[model samples]
Target: MADTILVLAWLVLAHLAADFILQSASIAAAKSGHGSRALAGLFAHGWIVAAVVVPVGFAFGERGWWFVLLTGLSHIAIDRAKVVLTRRAAAAALREAHDRHEAPRPPEHLGRAWTPQPAALFLADQGAHLAAASGGWAVLLAGVPLDPGWTAAIDGWLGSWDRVAVHGVASAAVVLIGLAIVNIRAASLFVGILVRPVEVTAGGEHRWGGRVAPAPDPDIRSSTSAAQAPVGRRWSIRLGPLDARVIAEPEPAIASPASPSTPPLGGSARVGSTIGVLERILIVVFVLTGTDVAIGFVVAAKTLARFRLLDDRDFAEYYLLGTLASVAIAIVSALIGRAALGALLA
Candidate 1:
């Protein structure tokens, strides 16, 4: 049973790494497009998945190759299904909006107070992939023994380390690595989808607190020439089931004086994402080591760094929603890791 669990963990870790870490942004975007580019992306992604899975399969023995074949094919099939479903849903949405005489919003920007269609689709896609992985494990690899040569090599490499201690360490490492990947890459994608930026017309009415509200900032119109100025924007921060707030967008690039020190938009987003990854990693470490209270310090320090920006209700709500989501995911991942570690070590 223990060996089965370890093998299952390796399979899951391989899947997560390939899907989120190894797959580049360009490849991910290309996969959603049409024709030859999409096929190329899918093939590239398949190779990546194979790269991660093949080594693990070989480590377990020849029979494990069957697991590799099952998992890899299922991944591609699931992804293709997701693409077809998303495109069909989008076309349907456009037709509905046309019939109602309403402007069609992109799927990513569909819902103001609820989960966006893109986010829901993303979750479903991932859920399907994971289910496939789990099902493959049960069918072909559930009772298979690890290769004797591989086990001997691991033991020899560890030298004088006690066997029980080595097993404990291996289990802990697997759990920690899996948790880190999910908390960092996967959570970033999820939160970004949920809190995507919204565009509105300058000085036009927009939804706020379940009602239409006029733009509050009178000086926004004079910030720049019409060509340079962006339309008004709002970020809907859903605080809870019954509570949501719309915050004004940050000053447009045209309004801010450009400096060599300023990062480009993409660079800025990358930096923010890096910070989020580090923050979640620290929280996971704190929770795993029985220093959960230290997680508070992590949150406090992050909030302090952006203290001045918090004065803007818009930025504050956006920041709060993101931070809360990050912290929640990290904490939950840590608790699960701790439980798995305890059970394995026992």
Candidate 2:
């Protein structure tokens, strides 16, 4: 039974490693200006997980194999679940934005078919988890003892029953981390809204509305030279910036609240201001996490700046502060993950 579990775990780990790296790479690719280094690094993370598990499998023999397999499955399952949930949320948000006439121009490649980056990323994540679950189970079922008498070789490190406990803990930690990330993201969004207001006008009236932010630099529009024109309008077609309706409204009261009391964090924050704060936070977090923060940062800045969230120079400063906060959070998250893993395993 132990050997079977061990083999399964190793297989799952292998599948998960491949899936995560590929998913991360895909996400990095879809966003603009994410450097090759960042992309390569994301693609490399799976290798680290793989490296740690392979040797353990070899050392503990059957038991070790089962441990690795089970742990791997757990990792994959948690990640996959998170991806599914996140994707659903992102898709809903995108649909709402589109319906409300607030959707950004989809990059040329996306046209009407393009889904949000988060949805794509989540799908990739789900793929990795699915591979781990099915592949790991298959490998274990195929061979009774992944290695006959393999459990005796290294009684030193894992020491029998400890292997199962360790793996159980590790798997749990992975799931917890996924849950934490989702929560943090949601909390960050709420916090952002509490601090700023976006100025959205519907027709001629001021309608303060928050929007689904876009990436700062999206895949640029495709070159017209390569675009195949539709059959009918070839000669008489004129391509130019479409005329946007202009409306004038009274200058919104720029004055601070009379009592100078700041609202509680994340509640009733104005749309433009909220985006500004959110972008600043994300920029800082991205730098610290060394993750490719998406074009949401750029959109937030542009929208907020357009609505007078901050003057140009002040916006720059706000982003700088946001970076610092993100770095701190990244460190804390890492530490918490490490501790959580240790506790679960121990």
Candidate 3:
């Protein structure tokens, strides 16, 4: 029992530390606020690690908590290696510039400033998991346990065949850990939305970085922007791919009490409806299984809703909804498979 507690402690600490370090590295490399992207990337990478660890853990006896602890530490190490390599490459770019006597040009800004591709995020996530796993294995060697099951499992990894229990608590542990990482990434994205926007002056023009402040209550716009309407109204709702329009309405003496300052794209009620649909899909998938199509539907719906790509808040919300939606589809797919089997048996 004492050993079990130690192993659990190691898991939590390793997860927290790896998450922080990987995110920091991502921020440094991306040269922008992609914190949420980093979180999602880390979660995706952890799943890749689990692919190896799950089989290995099953081969080894499921008794010792050491296996999991080691995997977590190794994950940390892999991430660190990736980060180090990335920095070195970036530095080399600067070194070449310096050698030529030309000013070391800052890294060129890529296609989109705020947007990041999903695949990059996934790769970053894998790096993080690798680092953690590396670190974890080192720790495990220091206080190893004896178990006949584990010995057999390691042999299996060495190409020996073994009839280890493939579908059981051990498998569930891997799935649950993956789910937890996804959840953490989603939660982190949600929090990143709340960070304050920075003000900057460049090229003799002033602009807000990251996000624009919420527009004043529509009703108070008469007093606030008496001569001109608020600026964000241009992107309030896009009529087409490029065209935008301002939505005007009579200003009430007092705005609705429930409306938050940053009215979150849609009103509160619409947001709730979107959130409900996402949660339903997740619950269904968890109970069932393998519902990628349904999950894809949810992902598409949320992405479309992101038409209001006016600020970082909208971007974060879009990804959060997508994450939940994908999970739901997976659960639904699994449920479908089970039902098919039941019918065949009948």
Q: Which candidate number maximizes TM-score? A: 1
So what's the TM-score on candidate 2? 0.32
When superposed on Cα atoms, how far off is each prediction in RMSD? 13.1, 15.8, 16.5
Segments of candidate 2 deviating more than 4 angstroms: 1-39, 55-124, 140-150, 157-346
Which parts of model 3 are misplaced by more than 4 Å?
1-122, 131-174, 184-293, 300-346
Q: Write the per-residue lDDT of candidate 3 for residues 1-346, one digit (tens) a residue.
A: 1133223333443454435434443333232213455445545555444443453354334522456545644554555455444333323332333344331111111111122222233346554554555455555433455466655555576574332443233334433443444334433332222221111111111111122212222333233223222233223665568665676654332221122332323354345444644554464454545454565565566557655552565445544544554454345434543453333223
- Model 2 per-residue lDDT tens digits across residues 1-346: 3444333444444444444333453343222123564335333443444454665466556655675656454553454344345434433443444455442221111112122344344445545655655555565444434453455554454666576667786566453544344225522433232222121121111111122222221211111111211223222333586544444553332222211232222243344334544554454344434564553555554545445533555444444434333344444544444454455445
> Which 10-residue window in model 2 sums to the lowest lDDT?
199-208
TM-score of model 3 vs. true structure: 0.32
Candidates' TM-scores? 0.67, 0.32, 0.32
- Superposed Cα deviation of residue 3, candidate 3 (Å): 16
- C-alpha lDDT of candidate 3 relative to the true structure: 0.38
Q: Considering lDDT, which of the candidate structures 1 and 3 is the better prediction for this target?
A: 1
Best by lDDT: 1
